[model samples]
Target: MTKATSAARDDRPPLLALVGPTAVGKTAVSLRIAEALDAEIISGDSMQVYRRMDIGTAKLPLAEREGIPHHLIDILEPEEPFSVSMFQSLCAEKIREIHERGKLPFLVGGTGLYVESVCYGFEFQGDSGDEAFRERMRHFAQAHGAEALHARLAAVDPSTAARLHPNDERRIIRALEVFETTGRPLSETQAQTRAAPKTSPYRLCLIGLTMDRAALYRRINERVDAMIAQGLVEEVEALIRSGVPQDAVSMQGLGYKEIAAYLRGECSLAEAVERLKRDTRHFAKRQLSWFRHMQDLVWAEADEEGKIDDLFKSICAIIAGKFHLDLEYIR
Candidate 1:
């Protein structure tokens, strides 16, 4: 493992990222990690950015943040659109300010694309050429199995293609589409982003939290049940009553979409709940897949009550030993 040698450099600010799936206990653990490192948190979640979209997103209650200074939460209304480029620019500013205020920046959330943008300094340049090409590639993959199309990508852009599973036909085709339209390999684009010297001011380490798949699935089921008890159906009903379109991103989230189906007479409430559970499990699986591909990361579990604190302590020890920062200040 090629660890970074510098503690604080001019290019990138030191950042510690806590990323995992929904219902995986990210909020509590992130708060502990923040306290341990004297860090302020920047939420990387796309959904949590909206104000009224609270319950569906499992957003941290105001009491939970406990004056720890979390950024980028509740910054938009559900009606507005937020993009990766907007997130990147906003986070960069917040990181710089937090560092100047003598606090570390902790990025915490389950949004993989948003986290990757901050970590890799990805340019969210609009690729206007991808849509049509992507549709054509998708049709081709559908006609001739996803494996064969992905295999074709592996021959041309092995690195980028390697990140995709054979079954992830969408991303595989998108990568191929990017290559076809741009005339530059997706691997080359990714490498350029990775190689581009970071402009953030913090050093960073990534931590991943996971548990047994069955256990995780159990927790997910419980969470869905709890969301239902918390009036998730009523929430969706209100959104529908208010004339919010089903196609809106806010409505497309796991709980909202399923309940919307129930409201439309497509399924029983019980069936909707089951579908929600299954969809959430699949979403968590995708999240874990993305996190597992990260180059160097620490993984922990959320079993006991203080387990998150213990994990935070472990991370603080590593950061202190490596960067000469005092954990006391953070505590």
Candidate 2:
């Protein structure tokens, strides 16, 4: 455990989060960090909350978590809708419980907004969202591409789209849907909310992972292949067979959507794999863009091949300094 903190004076919950693009090995790094800090992981992933959708969501097996208790994973049925507000509320509760148990709350995932919402105490409108609109947008992105969907958002709400990554089709579509439904830009609505007393309620330490573009793309491709080998197709097939709608929010996740298409006979397995690789690459790029736009994130370069220990040490150093505590840098 880190030492030398003014913990008695500060009342805010301490939040440590690692955010980055998928396939950048956030999970691998997080396990070591969490073990060192006596932290319980609260999954910041948007897709990992659903049950029976493990491989496609890249959920590390419970046996592989090294005994770190994880929250917000596999808590929801596929048909049950999840919203940002729901996540924010649930995560806040988890943070408190972890603190009560005298352990650090570690938020780990590649989902940008989900992590950011918890970090900043972001408030949202009462609207739960239009699932049909979102499904239409997802279909549009699947048919045309993420960039095209982003361009549509740019046309409707350029300010929101400008900050959002092109491959962040979900948020882009949300921005567009907000415009279409309310005749108001989501950016403007957010601006109005910022005028309120809304602010971060936690003492957040955020670490962002980055890598060389080519290197990361290679990893993304390799990850897609690994998932295929790990029975990702079978996982999606099981989900579909179990009555989860193809258009369900859970089904729209990265690997699940592509593999679902294959299971539906919409595309050959080979084609789905290639598309998954390409789309995941695009998704990783988008994640990088989103994190860059995010403030207060300490950047860390991750190289899976060489200098990995150095990267871990540097990240530990950042966390120690940011939180004003000593870190052991050991599991």
Candidate 3:
């Protein structure tokens, strides 16, 4: 290989990310990490992209970011569609830009797919934007033969082709559809996904924060209560009045879903709050599960006997140790 080719294959940019279950103090802890590393923040969150979701998503107000440059929050309308592929592309660019500026890209949020996709370079064959391609494939199969479609699939994704019988016209077309949409063979995408946790394109430090189960649940409940007090119901009400559908993907988020339920008279306010609390606790569990499956996550206790300073110090130490930096880089 040439020198440039060799370096391109061997060298990967450094990426630092903090992730955790909701209400686990990631925000406060991330601010410290950003300041310590002179990093810019890219939110690895799915819901925070929608505008007017402030209360439900718990977006940190700009004044409270401590002058940290944060990206990928509030960049979408509630009606627009977003997917993991979009976040992966946008976050990759942000990471590169941060590197060019001689600073770190600190990805901080709770969205598991969004965060891990960037860490491992998951090539997402996003939402089916290939109905036309599928139609054409089906037409070609009908006009020629299932055997011909199978041959074409073999030429592209032989692994997928080998497993599929020529008579399986639907599946053959689907695989070809995937190849057409993602510009990569379907087999390669599946293989990459299977190996994602084991492979990465970045020198990574991923920090996860957790606390005692009962304590985390308690915090979640309190956060739900606080959101109600902070007018979460009103926020949902405004979104609905502004023509955001109750079943929109953004509206389906934890707080918005439950409160929108209450607004539609499907439940009372008290019942909605209870459901939100329960669903949020469940969401936190799923988040933990997702992170636990990923390799090389350095875990820290965000509780530490309810001592924020202690938890922050421990997390800082984990990152510093992971990347071989002085732990006291915190300002």
Tens-digit per-residue lDDT, 1-331, candidate 1 = 1123445454556788888887777888777667656789999998888776777888878887878999999998666666777898999899889989978788998988788788767767774556877787777877998689889899888977766656556557767877787878887886666555654334667777777788789888998899899888888898788887765656766788788889999899999999989888888998898788665567776663335656667666666654556656546
Off by over 4 Å in 1: 1-11, 127-201, 304-306, 326-330
Q: Candidate 2: TM-score? A: 0.84
Best by the TM-score measure: 2
lDDT of 2 at 212: 87
Instruction: Please give the CA lDDT of all the candidate structures.
Output: 0.77, 0.84, 0.83
lDDT of 1 at 202: 49
- What are the runs in model 3 whose C-alpha is more than 4 Å off? 1-10, 129-197, 304-306, 328-331
Candidate 3 TM-score over all chains jointly? 0.77
Worst 10 residues of 1 by lDDT: 1-10
Considering summed lDDT, which 10 consecutive residues are worst modelled in model 2?
191-200
